[model samples]
Target: MLVSLAIATANQPPNIVFVLADDLGYNDVSYHGSEIQTPNLDKLAIEGVRLENYYVQQVCSPTRSQLLSGRYQIHTGLQHSYIGVAQPNCLPTEIPILPQWLKNVGYATHMVGKWHLGFYKKACLPQNRGFDSFFGYHSGSEDYYTHFRGGYGVSFDDRDHWLGYDFWDNDVPFWSAISNYSVFVFNDRVNQVIDKHNKSKPLFLYLPFQSVHSPLQVPKQYQEPYKNITNNNRRIYAGMTSCMDEAIGNVVEKLKTADLWNNTVFVFSTDNGGQILEGGNNWPLRGWKASYWEGGLRGVGFVHSDLLPSDVRGTINKQLIHVSDWLPTLVNGVAGYPLNYTNLDGFNMWDIINSNKTSPRKELLHNIDPWPYQPKDFNTNMTSAIRVGDWKLLTGTPGANNGQWIAPPGSGITPHLPLTIPGQNVWLFNITADPYEEMELSEKYPTVVKTLLAKLDTYYKDSVPVRYPDDSDQANPALHNGTWAPWE
Candidate 1:
């Protein structure tokens, strides 16, 4: 009986290890029908709950801001990607980040890989924000070989001097010539951090792997595992994904070896839906990473905790939860901490998760600024969208028609607001019945559109769009056009 009691207590309040994969698509994992053999991820899903309807912002920065702050991007002043030192980039200090909140409850917090929220010196980097230790780049993306380009540039501007390398260990310069194996290197670092933490205390580990993003390069071992696949894109993508899965397995093994597995709660997910075009498989879902479609925002999410009701194990949750829900959820459910943090649009999904309730969200919002450099026709801009239950309303150019902007009649910019004012783009949709958003019914439902549009107006008025530095285009070469932003 005592042994049984110990086993039951072992699984409660488990260490929360949140692993994020870069640009991973929905169908990339074998469990999701991908040719890739992601044993680690597959094992987690098989053993734990898999959230089928999890959602996040389309792009990286906004998603990062939402995940860390437990609020919408608009509330954090990071509605758009932080383009280098342009304007006031990165997540602002006013927002309470996940690590800070977790640390308050005596959880040792550590972040390894990709802190793309902001790139300015001293003001918005991960270490300053809340993370106790950060090992990664501070930009959007990094070159696999040269360590240049991508969303982040070749260099990072440290407070005193412009740091030559984009990599760092909490502010101290860290270098790795093994550009091709950056993900592997970061995984090692994450393991080291985990090993360093005190076993008795809870820990919040944020491992955001920069794998499968771009400049696709994978170790030969991971590649060999997927050689059976004939398609080169799928094969390579599978290899990269498999490598990350192995890394995850390694970390989980460490936890088990340390006897910390049962005490830890692990949440695994991607920043956004994977890229559909570049060997990414958002199977059965419409839209890619950048569009306001189901694939781009919906991701694979799983929460494993002994504290959850026994029925939750191996269960499937279809709740309308988003990235912003993590902070409050963890605080309320895991840490036994109280958070009076207000102005947050996310809800605690604890009750829904525990009771297996089908309580759908009354409404949700998706706002993305125009990726101007994306050959205007091939990308979206300044769109204000809302998801109410199963219906989603989009105002602005529905940048979904193969990147071609679709302007519905009477859905133009407010005449009084200047085009440069930002957040003018808008649209609406009935998402539940038509998740793909193939049909636009804004014309038929005028009153619903008007009500949602008013909500957007209030949100926009309260929030400020990320301002591009006057010299952003010139300063950031990637911003020149088309190139995906690299985390420097």
Candidate 2:
């Protein structure tokens, strides 16, 4: 039995290990009928409850910010795009974030892998944000082996910069792992953290892995399994994914070996949809990442733990879960912690996860990004979208019709086939009836579209100004001794 937070007791609350994958698509894993094999993810997901209707933002930092802040991007002024490598902004420090809350309750917090949230100031770094230890990159993406990030353009203000090492340990730059595969380095570090953890105290491990994202690089051995794949990009991407799966399997093994598995709630999710142009396929799910389509926003997620009710284990939960729900759900509902924090956009979803109760959440604000957008090529079109119950509304281009159904390599299907959906600025869909968004009904259901638009206006009125800034020359890693570190 878990101990109540009110009184310090012998029984410890369950340890939480949240693993986030970067740019993983709904169709990338074998469980979802993809050609890529994700044996470890498949095994663990089947043993746990699968989140069929799970959703996340269409990009990296927005989903991550909402996950940690327990609030929408509009609330945090991060509604535009991801935190650029040379951008001066970070997730607002005024807002209390996840690790700090868990640490306040006595969990020993450790972070490994990506920290794309923000690192413009020392206070915004992970260590200052309540993590006892931090190991990872502060930027969005980088070379897997060299640990070097390119394309900063802030390189001496030349707009083409030399690669700089981005790996770190806590607030300091780490170089020992340079040229070593990042996934392996992270996996090893996770084992060390698990092995050194004190069993009497609860643990909070947040691993936002840089797997399956880009740079399309993985160890050659992992790629051997997919040499049969004809498409070069898909083959490499498959290898990167398989490598990430192995790391997860290893972490689970480490937990069991340390006797920490029994009391651990293992949650796995993707930051957003795949980048189809970069060898990702969200077949039959609309568009790819950076779009407003279901393929971009609907995420692949699952939770595994011994704490789930036995009857619900190994079943599918169709609850309308969103990325922002983790914070309140973990604190108030699962850990039995009081609701000391308020003004949150997320709901306490623990009951829905554990007991299979109907989710208290009926509405979700997907995003209100200001930039004009279309996936295939750039064009200006507003993409403010929202969902209420069975209805979903999108203002501007949904970006679903660009080369639809880019299948995995050697699937006997040709590539670059276009979807026939016409371009429209406003679309309304009964999502429950059309999960794939096969039909747009803005004209048919004029009232519903009008109502949802009004709701969006209310949210827009409450949103903070968007904080995206030009890539600062001051953020040049060359200025920070060739490592991405806090400059301010």
lDDT of each: 0.67, 0.84
Clashes counted in candidate 2 amount to: 1
- Candidate 1: which stretches are off by over 4 Å? 1-13, 85-88, 145-164, 176-180, 228-230, 358-360, 368-382, 400-428, 471-488
List, residue by residue over 1-488, the lDDT tens digit for candidate 1.
Answer: 22342366553344788888888887777887666788888888867778887888887777878888888876665665444533335577677788888888777888998887766547577777778888887664566544454323424342222223456677755655435477767878877887798866678899888877876667677778766666566677778888888888998888888777766778887887676545676755666677766777778778766556677788888878888888777776666577786777777766676667764467777874543442222122446567777777665553334322221112242222112224434445677776655566766887887777676666666665545443233335333232222233
State the lDDT at 475 in candidate 2.
73
Q: Please count the clashing residue pairs in each candidate, in the order shown.
A: 35, 1
Q: Provide TM-scores for the models.
A: 0.82, 0.94
lDDT, candidate 1, residue 245?
A: 88
Best prediction by TM-score: 2
Per-candidate RMSD, Å: 8.4, 3.6
Best by lDDT: 2
Off by over 4 Å in 2: 1-10, 152-157, 371-381, 400-405, 413-423
